[model samples]
Target: MNTTPSMTLERQRADAASARRPEPKPATGSFQTVEPRLEIAPAGATGGELVDRYGEILTPAALEFLAALHDRFAGTRHELLAERLQTRVDAANGRDPRFMPETAWIRDDASWRVAGPGPGLEDRRVEITGPTDRKMAINALNSGAKVWLADQEDATSPTWANVVEGQLTLFDFLRGDLGYTSPEGKQYRVTAEETPTIVMRPRGWHLVEKHLTFHDRAGRAMHASGSLVDFGLYFFHNAKALIGSGRGPYFYLPKLESHREAKLWNDIFVFAQDALGIPQGTIRATVLIETIQAAFQMDEILYELREHCAGLNAGRWDYIFSIVKTFRSRGRRWVFPDRKAITMTVPFMRAYTELLVQTCHKRGAHAIGGMSAFIPNRRDPEVTERALAAVTADKRREAGDGFDGTWVAHPDLIPTARAEFDAVLGDRPNQVDRLRDDVEVAASDLLDIPSIGGEVTEAGVRDNVSIAIRYLESWLRGVGAAAIDNLMEDAATAEISRSQIWQWLDNNTVTAEGTRIDQTSIVRLMAEAVAALPRFEGDRFDDAISVFRTVALEPEFPTFLTVGAYARFL
Candidate 1:
């Protein structure tokens, strides 16, 4: 939180530039910048010359919009994040999560509907998600899906280079000129006559962008919110362009815990549109009901962002991780079985998804389902077939249960997912009209994990350690989503994997093989995992081991391992 003397001087210089700059004529579209006082300087931690191409996306107008967003909403974001910590503490001390008594009116009111889907978001049967690297961007856009969730959050490592490059990549994609020639001399581009609609997922509210530091009114150097930076840059530069193309700035909001957080996003959207001179509801966002508390507040969340809301998504990995984090202190009563056992078929998960579909359709919003994290392996035909079949079954279940759409991490799995949805949807764009009046889920149903039982296995423990370490190493090496043993492993998955180990240790969990897991056993497993992974030339794997040790074995569990682990990048 402290700023060095040099950073202070840099902040002063930037402040002076803002003070001296004069108001400028607006840009040539409905959205424009009235004043151009923004000057961005690197925060000195990850200093490297940005590519000249980055200038195309990080224009003065874009930075000014970001500055305005930070000025208006960063304080509220800070307060909300603090509120999250307190809320978690309260939940730990027996403050049960239930539908808010005060928000019952909003939930009961069935007359209102979220502003209907914008142009490109109408029929999102299948959405491919990935970090916005150039090749992946081209592949995802070209994938035969209706939408691509261009991710900058969990799917991406927040390296300075990755952040800026992602912006530039998206900028190029919007212009319809984004393409990549692989090192093997193969070319990739958006070959489809109608490429997938893009929905960008910015970093969650908890993460910060250390590379872009701003000063508060008290003259303290503060890291910019990653959410603001990602949303600001994309919207500032591309809102009008996307609007012209009949597609607007669509987003996927992640890890929100309450309606208040959704309200914050709504306020930010309103402010951003107003500042840029765009229409009031030009932005559309789908909130990921990934947290347990968020699952309870679906209707209220939709109401908060109704004007700009697209729908709600059921996120698998993060939803499981949230369960562990929120109820870790509640003893074996909240203890989970093996991560593999808690599938979509489980009672609690089914309750959550059924309630989500009912709530979204009841409010005339699309209910998207969780990701199918199966990546096909080229060498193993058998494995690929099995994975595709599993993906098919999952999508079939979602479609049958009235989900409008779902997510796939790899392009190869898109067709399998799309086919399942097609069988249900046929000619319909979405099942928002499927009110799902037959479903009724209670608070107890959502918290019924204890009843669905299985034992922790040594294989489960070793798999958790192996996957976490591998994913963390890749993350530290500037790759957020890594394909380890055919599954797409992201920060959310890693969080679950590592946190389960922590929980198992905290509760003195006995594996099915009658072996008790303790700190020493976990350390031995960690060493074995490290030995199994192929050694690279650098210290990234070592650093990942230490980070895993801290998060998995430390006395107190950190809310998000990425928060502390990211500092190692700096």
Candidate 2:
């Protein structure tokens, strides 16, 4: 402890010399090797502190591993790690079916009240007939569609005259003077006015190859940039530029099948937004759910780009074709009728509707029903009234069944459909109450019994049978049909009742042997059922029962019954 300064200096010099000298090599048979040690700070410690602490705990071998980990997690590199983790999180959450339920909880709460008024028919459909008629186009726009699809997809001619004229006319509508004709053989003139209702559906993706032309104002041909040759690119660029000028049309996204396809569109939208200096959410999109796969995975597709999606539409004809094509390979194994003869009451249609309603409601979206293809016969008052009446009835039924709105093919049908929806849903209680109750009942543990065989007694079965038979009888006779509580009957009881009825038919238990078990008989039976139920009221339920009975009594019913009977026989 009491060393002289010269002795201390000599000791330090000896230590420095020792540090500079090379370390001794290990012997071939040596057993002593240094092991690495690592130190980890508490979870919340800062990077610098953690690094210092880690250095303190690390042996030579551990220092290398710590340096690698630190380098991987540092600065811009950390964002890459975060992205990888986020991707894993997305995959995990996306795979969970329960994720939708949790995500939809807020929507479920908000949709509890019946949907309020939305952008009406005046906000959804537009018609364009002539190829280059700007006046006609402007007049059509007067119909007031929120977004108009100037359809080069289906409505335009394939000739160059038509195509160029159409393009020029569209330009004129946006930039040049437009002239109008009055009823009294007078002409009215107006200049170009910016309108939001003029989206163009360029010839489809497959047909773009046929429409490539590169020419300037001098009518001289110019070399086409391979990128500009694509119709999608051209349309995208021009539309984006027009949008920058505050005159662009929102896109009606077509032919999307997968979430990847949606993301592709989202990418394009993002590009357009950045290039045009437009706000990200300013451009709206309505995805056409036409393909079978699109229908099933629509929720995922929408959720992927929910910020960009305006809404979705039920593309009926394409959907019908999709269904037939999708199931055609299954051959006779499928029980459904030929596609042409199938009605909306079929199970397929029911499933589609259910899925559509659920998806739209879960996203706080407007559930617009399919179009009525009926046209009015205005010459005959009776025919017109009947058509209007039929449309009103159909729309009312759809609205009552929980659709927010519907589409009509003709301009005249729009007002009627709107009126029907307004009449049905404007003042009524929301349908969400029933959905909430059902969800609650389904989730309750008390209702989780495995089987009803021991619990359902003979007396209980007999009472249900008796009630069902009486209800069926009243329904068939069409007596007091408006008073049946059809929803209160369980599926088991309905099956038993139908079984008993068939048994009676088979055993010749009824007195009228010659009376065929036809549609009429089925209708009467359902009417009887409605009459027997005490809790039900209103003609609305009766109407529903009538429709259901009609469906049940179709010729297909017998075919279904025969199949079931034969299967049981085997």
Tell me, by TM-score, which candidate is best. 1
Off by over 4 Å in 2: 1-139, 144-149, 154-169, 175-207, 213-248, 333-340, 379-386, 424-570
Model 2 Cα displacement at 160 (Å)?
4.4
Candidate 1 residue-wise lDDT, 1-570, digit = tens = 111223333443443343331122234655533332334555465553456687776776677777778767777786677667666666776787898899999988879999868989999999999999999888887788899999999999988788989998988877878888889999887788888888999999988887666654434456678899999998888889899888999999999999999999999999988888998988999999999989989999999999999999999789999999888767778878888888999999999999999999988888998887777898999889989998999999999999999999988898899899999999999988988899989999999988778889999999999999999999998999999988889999999999999889888888999998898999999899888777868748889999998898886677899989986664
Worst 10 residues of 1 by lDDT: 1-10
So what's the TM-score on candidate 2?
Answer: 0.46
RMSD of 2: 27.7
Model 1 TM: 0.92
Flag clash pairs in model 1: none
TM-score each candidate.
0.92, 0.46
